[model samples]
Target: MAVRKIEHVGVMVTDMERSIAFYRDVLGLETLGTLDHGNGTIKLAFLGSPGAGETQLELVQGYTGRLAEEGKVHHIAFTVDDLDAEIARIAKLDVTFIDPDITVLPNGARYRFFYGPDGEWLELFQPA
Candidate 1:
């Protein structure tokens, strides 16, 4: 068997429009399209930067059960060229940051955590 790369990451959201706006407007991602599954039991909206190929963030709607905890499968990280600028942009939106300061890893990478529209943990990572 062979593994190439990640195609996309799917996130179950409560509201489609709000989630779409958070990713599209706040994160500066482009909406590729949407898909409906199980006769509308699930709706997915694909979003990513232009020319990003198969790497995308899939926002899903329709599930009302319990969600995963913060450090579990509910977290997603995005690599940014300018973490400070991205954080400033995100501050203008209605998002909440978990840490008041950016965390520097042992390798010198910087990262900060924030919550999405649905309380999903999102991270901004900057490589050293």
Candidate 2:
């Protein structure tokens, strides 16, 4: 068996509009599309960067089940060229940062954690 690459990451959100705005306005991601799930209850919105073939973010709404303490998934990380700049930009928003300061791995990669509109863990990672 062989796996190529991840198609997209799905996140559960309470409000579709709010989630779309947060991922769009705050994170600079564009909404690729949206649709009602065949189940007739869940609504999904797919978002992604402008570039072709970038991993997409899928927002799932109307999920009645309980979410884990962390969120829909453990966390979703976005690659950043300038972590400091991104940190400063997010600071001015009405978001919460999970990390007090940037964390540096042994390889010199740095990352910071923050919360999304629905309390989902989001991260900005800068490679060494």
TM-score of each: 0.52, 0.54
TM-score of 2: 0.54
Q: Please provide, for model 1 over 1-128, each residue's C-alpha lDDT reduced to its tens digit, 9 standing for 90 to 100.
A: 12234445667787889999998888899898886754567776879897867567878788557765533244566777778888888888867999898987544768788988877777776756
Worst ten-residue run, lDDT, model 1? Answer: 1-10
Q: Model 2 segments beyond 4 Å from truth?
A: 74-128
Clashing pairs in 2: none
**Residues 27-124 of candidate 2: C-alpha lDDT, one tens digit per residue:** 89998888775465878787999786677787989978898756676467677778898888878886699989998755476878899898777778
* 66: Cα error in model 2, Å: 1.3
In Å, residue 100's CA in model 1 sits off its true spot by 44
Clashing pairs in 1: none
RMSD of each: 13.6, 13.3
Q: Alpha carbon lDDT of residue 105, candidate 2?
A: 57
Candidate 1 positional error at 92, Å: 50
